[model samples]
Target: MNRFAWLDAFLGRLIAEDMAVREVPEASGLAPARGISVGADDWGNFGKSARNWNCRWAGCWAEDLGDQLRVHACFEKDHGYLLAHTDLRRATPILSSHAPYFPAAARAERHLQDLYGIAFGDHPDPRPWIRHQAWKNGEYPLRLDFPLAGNPLPATPADQGYPFQHIQGSGVCEIPVGPVHAGIIEPGHFRFHAVGETVLLLEERLGYVHKGIEKLAETRDAHGLARLAARVSGDTTVAHTWAACMAMEKAAGIAVPERALALRAIMAERERIANHLGDIGGICNDVSFSFGFYQFNRLRELWQRTSATAFGHRLLMDRIVPGGVTTDLSETAARAQIDQISTFRPQLGRLMDILNTSPTVENRLIGTGVLAPQAAAAYGALGYVGRASGVDLDVRRDSPYAPYHTLKIPVPIEQAGDVAARVRVRAAEISASFAMLEQLIGGLVPGPVCAPWTPAPPDACGFGLVEGWRGETLAFVRFGTAGRIARYFPRDPSMINWPLLEVLIADNIVPDFPVCNKSVNGSYSGNDL
Candidate 1:
């Protein structure tokens, strides 16, 4: 059956039940998705219906208008996306939560509660997710009246008093690990309940580095917003920026030049390759496999240097603008990148052989940090984390845009959900990215890189979804008067994937935590934003 056929059928079912639904005209522009508005009372029923049809929960974000608040929930099945949103009066902003149907909604809802002051009825984890008391009570920074500089408390209190879930039992030890770490990584606290070396439970408390990216995004022009999106997660700069630009383009009803779309895809593939290589190396280093560590990092270094030669920036930051890309790929640089990918394949294959055959490496990784397929699905895990556990979904293949709609993107999956499975998935993704780069560069089109910008109507909204290196990245944009950003929310894949770490860490020894953590490598900046 056709994907849209399924979407139509689903809509009919909703309408039959007297649910308020209207098609969004902007869906025909930048994405192959559908959008609808539901009554606030029907929002929970929408979640029930989506769960009944086994829809994958994409993400949810809240927007604050002057007198009301709007909450949106996104779901996917096959190649079709359904965006359901409802408005609530700010005076009484109470709504049913979707956490009961989608476990992934728990953290996002808590985040919405903290930032928007919207009350979610029957939310699973009611404790604040992003609020560490940076602002005083009754101050919701995302609201229009809240100052960008923020109303600072005369004296900010210490954040040492969060009530963590205590596990009490004979011989059960609690080990608290950081909001500050010995390593040079972002701040996050992890509390572990262990009996000897075996971990009984692991709970993570993050939001220590929240930069208020959402609050800062308001009123920025398209170009400024795109630059800000690039920094949402520096490692996934290309994908995040492209997603942001895609959303803005959709909002403005602009078409990017075909050649620019090709260049964008090429840059995105390069980003996926670079991150996977660095992570694969880091995972090996955690297991004391120095040979694999050095070899993979060397490959990553070469890959990035080649990117620098091909693109102006090694990380390709700010390469994606509102309607298209900043620069086009030259024939000479394209040939160099093709050669780089050709040379990388053999070395990667050799490394895979070493990992597959080495008993010592297998002992450390094969069964460590195993996440059940059921658990993966429950949380709506994305990218390799979900794919390794058999939750086979990829935004590129599922909701293709521009060049990806023309290319044959392959999604690799593994049944094992352990650290070894995660490493193998990353390796396979690098190979797939190489294949895409070849297709994108070899069939490079000729045209202008960017389109002429036309301002969107006031209060127009659009969505952007991209398959980032880590997983499905989502961006929501609403344009205000004069084409300024009214609201911008970029849902990094890490937001959904971070909670899975706690699920996978249980039953593993403390020593194996490094490899498990490296395998997932959830971005602090991405989620904290």
Candidate 2:
């Protein structure tokens, strides 16, 4: 279906199901499609949309009446039902069946259950998703009524009798790897049941870094909330900040200047290139390719230095604001930097050729951590992981937001679904992003970078989605009369992708864990938040 027509049909389906539909223009000047009003509560307004083709149209439901609980769904746009607030609260048997429809929804529902003490009656896997035994059965820390200061901390949940499915056979043995590891990475435990050299089953225990980011957002204004979003994951600061600001501008009906949109796109592409470069090197390092590792790491450092000089932060934190960008591009500096990238191109090409021909590297990565196309779909994986498995979905290309529509995005996909494929995808994406950067700089326009945004009216709701380096990042925000945030939900791609680690690790040997883990590379900090 064509874009506009498809949106109309989708909206018709929602309207038939009793949702109040509204066609709203792009408030942040990004020009997404229609926004439908889902409902409203004392906390603020609620809404939904299928703004981008690759994106799921999710329900943004919030309640500020007392507990200030915010609940939402991030299901596929074409294949899910919208459950009304009244229907959700009928005390009817909680339907646990939604997970089967959208696997991403499973993690989100579990998060709601943990923070709001709401029951997902029939939730297929209701096994205490994010509630890590810090609170009792009746306590919900996210509730507004819950004391913000000096709340008694509950004891950690006891580990005695906690159940994990075991795989058994004549030669099977279990190997456990950390909720704490040797690396500086965040905590998560992986259990592998292996028979000789092959793995029979894999299970993961996460949630070691949950900091109640959503709950904290309730107490901050837009700027404060932006800071919180930037901290969702250090590596994904630009993406998170952009999503937060997009939501804020939408809520306030603020239109950012065209120049600001261009600058945001430039930073986003740089972020993508930087991350891909680092990951490529890290993946090589895992496989003992010291030469490749050193070269790629050096390149990555160069890219980061460029970002630090251009954006004032190596990771570009706080570079995005509600009405546009926090900084403007320096044409003279950008031109000089483009020259550096041009010089680095041949070096990157030589390194790619060397890595592609390295037999040892190829042997380890070619058939490891394979995620079949169907399995990837069932898990709802995104970003490089999904692309490697043949999903072929990229939010920038499929959604065409901002500068992406003006400059068509090229999506690179592979069917291997293995470590090698992921590495290749990253390599190709880095090249593509560099090309995009060149084009963006060449077409640089001059104008105001930010538009002034007044505070949003009380009870206004907004939703924002950005194609982060990892995948699609989404934020739902609601504002109060006093210009403070009433409710906020930021859904990171890690939340959906992390669960797939368990599925993909099955049947692989314990020795291959490093390559497998690097292939998925789900962000623990992002998920825990």
Residues 305-327, model 1: lDDT tens digits: 98888888989998899888888
TM agreement with the true structure for every prediction: 0.97, 0.88
Lowest lDDT block of 10, candidate 2: 40-49
Q: Would you list the C-alpha lDDT of every candidate in the order shown?
A: 0.88, 0.73
Q: Give the TM-score comparing model 1 with the true structure, all chains together.
A: 0.97
| Residue 226 in model 2: lDDT | 89
Worst 10 residues of 1 by lDDT: 23-32
